[model samples]
Target: MKRIAIIGAGASGLTAACYASGDGRHVLLFEKQKKIGRKLLVTGNGRCNISNRNIIAGHYHGHNSRFVDAVFSRFSLQDTITFFEELGVPFIEEDEGRLYPASLQASTITKVFQYELKKRNVDLQLHRRIERIEYEETGFTLYTAGAEEHRVDSVILAAGSCAFPPAGASNIGYDLARSLGHRVYEPWPVILPVTIPLKSLHQLQGIKWDAAIRVEVNGKEQERSVGELLFTAYGISGPVSLNVSRSVNAAVIAGKSPVVIIDLYPSMSGDDLARRLDRLWSDGGKKTGFSLLGIMKERMPEVLCGIAGVDPEKRVASLTPADKEKIAGTMKNLILEPGKPRGFQEAVAAAGGVDVDEIDPATMESKLVRNLYITGELLDVDGDSGGYNLQFAWSTGAIAGMAQ
Candidate 1:
């Protein structure tokens, strides 16, 4: 049997091990962490959202997205469900296509991968930090920080990106790709919190609410997502912010100024909101501005009052027609300036990895070197929040393992 070396036993590396070993090939996996899946343990805050019921490779960003499309077509969402079900990990899909194991435990997801590795008798090495790889005429030699060397017939670079540094993410894979005559794309942070302007910081702190937010750059709509909006000491966070961040980054890198519009009431249209506000004002003419907004977003009536251009001291009967129009506009369009994003150290995942041009997307094999394949975040493809990132890892790993 041919021998294969897989580095970094995160979601991708371990999946590759399970697949390559299943082919009756000797698979050796090296994990830098003391235990594998440290990052997976914190994914979905430990719920371990494996893969979404909706898997769209178009959501992924890369120099050549066609490569991602081809790979995902092979190991699609249905394949992921069937594969996990075969391992006794039944999944339940939440709203918006997010999928989690029925047990709702990340440990369960990791355990199944570990079980597969054990069943295949794949060599799983923990606390093993790979230092470098020297490509030979026939194979490659791996040097590790452990003062050891191993020669293997094929190598799959599955080391993830620099996100979740606490999870033992390292740069060994990037260095290997660069050193081995491949063009590595400069990695950027994605799926991160958006830094707020001073006005937003002063006006909106310690605020938490569910709202639909859309990011626009240079008058072009970039991304739109609706979820809980969390106000931090520094900026805005939560699912909406994180989901829109990729577009924000894409624009910022392209030299476009970014803006965010928060639809505090996505369910209500301008005309509908105007009618509702008029009804409320007619019913509560004697109430104060703060007292009138209790009908909508009870969590922050005072803030909503400011957004609606209602004077705090003014009674509802004192409002003008123009005031109602202002209220409707502001309710639908609460403008915010989204400044630079936080670094990759805080992102859910990073964009830009080993250049897709340097690797054959079909087999994920390095185009510049023999018996070398690449997978996981080390590749240039990243997806939207919903479990699409993990699915990319799985599909790419499967393709790499099959080629090996």
Candidate 2:
């Protein structure tokens, strides 16, 4: 049996260890932390979204898409469910195709795998962080933080990206990949909130409104997502913001300033809204701008007034055409200029890693390194929230495991 060393012990690496062991390979899984699955426990807010009902290539963003496609071609969604079932983790799907464990606890899923691996006699090494990987003529030698080394027939770098550094996430995989002669794509903070510099905007922080945000790179529509937009102390956070974060990060990575346009009232046309406001002013017993009912939620009148540079005490009868137009424009589209996003500590996941083109997708094995494989967030692939990213992890993990 070939000796296999799997790094990281997160979802991908542990899954790889299990799969490699199932193939009668002597599998050794190493983790830097005292325990495995720190990141996994945080997924789905501790419920652990295991996979998705709709496993489509469109859901994934990568430097190489075809590689993931090929892996799914071999072991798809059904295979993932079956693998989890065999491990005794029952799962159910919420709305929007997000699948979670029936027990609804990430700890449960992690426990199941830990139990299964022990039952199967897999060597799991926690607190043994790998320092370096040496590709020798016959096999690979892995030096650890504890000053010991393990020689293995192949090394699977399921080592994740640098998102949760506290959880022991690092760029060790990228380091290993480049050291062994593979092109590395630049890593960026993704699935993160955009930080705006204006305190006026920051005052509205924590306010949430349904907004359609469009990210532009040099006047080009790079990304768009429409949903609840959250105002933050530093900038914006929310579903729409997180979804478009990839485009923003990508532009920044390409050395361009990322710009975002927000439509606070995307569903309602600005002209119609203005006309309605004008009508309300004339008919509502001559109500003041600040006291105008139904213009928005009660708490928002003051903010809108500030944005339009209007007196809150001004009566609707006294509101000029210029005033109405400015209000309409502000409500329609608010321009938010952002600085760099919060680092990996605040990110859901890092953006880039091992280039998939350097590996065979069907097996996830390195094209240059014999028997070496790649999987999970370690590969340069990310997905939108709503559990898509966790699903990618489980799907990629299952595929890599099955391949071994």
Candidate maximizing lDDT = 1
The most accurate candidate by TM-score is: 1
Model 2, range 1-404, lDDT digits (tens) per residue?
A: 87888888888887776776765677788888888889989877678877778788887888777766787777777877888888888779886678898999999988988897797778989888888888977999999977798988888888888887867778887887788887777887888888878666777777888889998877888888888888888888987888888888777767898788888778888777777766667654454555555756654666666766876677777777787777677677776667776799878888778888887777788898877777788788887777766666666666666666
CA error at residue 140 for candidate 2, angstroms: 1.8
Minimal lDDT window, size 10, model 2: 284-293
Which residue pairs does candidate 1 place in steric collision?
A: none
Per-residue lDDT over 1-404 for candidate 1, one digit per residue giving the tens place of the 0 to 100 score = 78899998888888788778865688899988888888899888799878887676567888887887788777777877787889899898897889999999999988888888888999988888889888889888999997799989999988899886877876778998888888888888888888876452545666777889998876878779998888777778888888998887777788888888889778888788778777677744465456555555443555555756677567767777787677668778978776776887788898888888877878888888888888989988888988889988988888887776
lDDT of 1: 0.81
TM-score of each: 0.93, 0.91
TM-score of 2: 0.91
